[model samples]
Target: MIHNKKEFNLGIALLVLFFIVLFAMFQPLFDGHNAMAYLDNLYNSISKGSAHYVDALKEEAKTLAGYNVKVTMNMEDEAQAADSVALITAAGGTASAQGKALTINGDYVAILNACLNDADKLYNNDSAALKAKYPALAGKDDRQAVYNWYKILGGFDKELKKQEAFAQAKVAFNVNSKVVETAYNYYKVVPEQIKNKIGIVIFSLVFYVIYTMWYGFAILFVFEGWGLKISGH
Candidate 1:
């Protein structure tokens, strides 16, 4: 009775320990998923919010470009000959500002895309096509001067596409960064090193259990050779 009681208690203790270990192993996996999901949503919201600002910048650039063109056309009229020089100067200023805004905004989008490991190759190819269509703008040191309302209005569809692509890339980059950072932080505890250690420990315990059973069988055989009979009821 005593021997059987001891064996029963040992088995119960091992079963409890097994459950505890299993919980420890799976808890992190479950929690990590939750953390990742939350972070992804957060970054997606941020990207969506920032998209408005990018759109605003693009609109401002287009507006200034349009104003500059209007002023330039007005300056060409004989009725405005007396103020032509002043209008020309104003148009030049607007062009310079518009160019700077477009360049800065485009670069900002490109940098964000690069962060996400995306090169925005389609945008580059399309921009190249635009440049090809307007060779004058491509060759001029002052692209703003050549990218007047006439040129942009002539290819408004392509210009709009380029703007949309830039905005998309920027948002994608922000979202990707959030996902990466969240995963990195959440999985730190259950990293490869910890998993490897757990695997080794499990294998060692399995080996120990097998070896112990083999040794017990060998002892039983020796006892039988000595004319001892071991029986179980």
Candidate 2:
């Protein structure tokens, strides 16, 4: 009986230690009373930044379109006819460039939507829905599904940054032109802080799972050890 009591006390102590370690590991996730708040903030930042960037591109396109119309309307002015024609041609090229930017932005938005959808599915623990929605992930298990979703999000952010850099470079090369300069000035990229936050969010997500698994195994060990002690007694 004394041995059994000692074993039970040890089990309780082990369980307490397990919880302490688990809590320490997941402290970041527990902040603000929302385990996934960092992830949500990261997603929101990306979505809002991308939307604003796309809108700015559209506005730049509209500006060039207007310039094209103006140049065309003033083509009859003999003194400025050559200059007008040149401006019109430049405007057409700039407008085409902006259109391409918009197309790229659309692609980014699509990827972002997929990321958000996957996140929702993960949050709801709807593994079946995730598999159904993403046929490529149909065969993956639950943990794998979560990892794949995270990978997709990380890839999307990387691609978005690359595309943004390319767009910015395009605008910079044409900075001598007023319209291009205006577009360049209006270009908004994801902030560095948000990018760092994404890393933190991903880390927290992965650690959350790891810590939970550890805690479960610790509990199992404690119970098994206590059972052995009781049988011995």
Candidate 3:
């Protein structure tokens, strides 16, 4: 029941070409990576490139110099407690662990710098060095150590708020959010500037829009050629 043979034939041709392009996209065409996966990695690298603010954060931390804060962080277990103690002592802070409780007293800035240093190492994908420094973490995933940092810092933030040392607590929150979280999530991703991949990035976006429309138009042409129409009654 074709009303226009030429239009329906044109639609079939376009629809066939669309499937061909889609099938090609799913192939290992770009350096053995499918187009979507390559683009996903490209965007992730670009974002990680600009997301490094640890150095700047370290500098800002120095402004909290001379501020002494004390908090007893409650950890999940003795193993985690021992790990926290190591991190605190490395930052030149005094930490004593009893059972699962870790008492910390130190210049918040110095301690913050230590956390940043560890995060920087992870961000650069130098997990071997991080594991080497912490003997307890040997043969274990390095992210476990970073997660300890996250938990310990979260403890610091909550305890500081209780003592009404809001400024110092704010510092903890910022570092946890900005540096520690980013490093943990983007682990092993080599960052690069988006401008370098501008050509491919733009091409992908444009192709996405055009290809979507191509499918829609093909459907519309086919329906119209079959004398189908929407009308206001």
Candidate 4:
């Protein structure tokens, strides 16, 4: 009867050991979906925020372009006037009185002010200023020099808008790349590492349990053998 009880106890222990090993080996498999969900959320948040920031930066660049045009035109005319004055001063009244050159103060002043006010409008984001500035260049094409200046200013504005668009595209592309990279690292790489570590731990415990079970069986078998011999069975 005692020998039967020992065999039943050993069987029960082996069954328990099998269940424990299986549970340990596969526990983390259930967490797979959960980890993926978190990674998706992180990707969405980063990508959305980055897109918004890029749009805002592009708008700012466009505004800066408009503002720069006005400032540059005004400064250029001012420099030309200063150069004329410097020449007159250096040569005394003789240079000014020379029939070889002339400076039209009225036209230059009008154009210079027009450019300055337009630039200020861009800075202030005033639509009214844009409307007011464009018409100032109309029909007064008599000042061919000033008209050329206006053309240059217009070209610069167009280039600036192009730059803004380019910048926006660059920012969006970089943001997307970063988000994808982060998701890949977290979900694919990090989870793989976690799974490996857990597998190692489970395997170690399984072997330990197997060893214990073997020792238990060996001990029981030896004791039974001794009893049988003592009883002369």
Best by TM-score: 3
The parts of candidate 1 lying over 4 Å away from their true place are 1-104, 113-233
10 residues in a row with least lDDT, candidate 3: 136-145
**Highest-scoring model, lDDT:** 3
Better of 1 and 3 by lDDT: 3
C-alpha displacement of 178 in model 1, angstroms?
Answer: 6.4
Listed per model in order, the count of residue pairs whose N, CA or C atoms clash below 3 Å is 0, 0, 0, 0
What is candidate 4's local distance difference test score?
0.37
The sequence of per-residue lDDT tens digits that candidate 4 reaches over residues 1-233 is 45556655665566567567656544444355443354444444444333223234334334323221211212234433333333223222211212322232222223333333333333233434343444433333223223233333343334435656444334323322333223222222222233434564466569768867766765565456334334555
Model 3 pairs in collision: none
TM-score computed on alpha carbons, candidate 2:
0.30
The residue-by-residue lDDT of candidate 1 on 163-194, one tens digit each, is 55443434333333342232222321221232
| Candidate 3 local distance difference test against the native | 0.88
Write one digit per residue (lDDT tens) for candidate 2, span 77-158: 2422332222223222211122112112223223333334443344434657656654554564543444433333333334
Q: Estimate each model's TM-score.
A: 0.20, 0.30, 0.94, 0.18
Higher-scoring candidate on lDDT, 2 or 3: 3
User: Clashing residue pairs in candidate 2, if any?
Assistant: none
Q: Model 3 over residues 46-141: C-alpha lDDT tens digits?
A: 999889999888878888889987999899999888877888888899999899998999988888998999999998988887888788888677
Ranking by TM-score: 3, 2, 1, 4
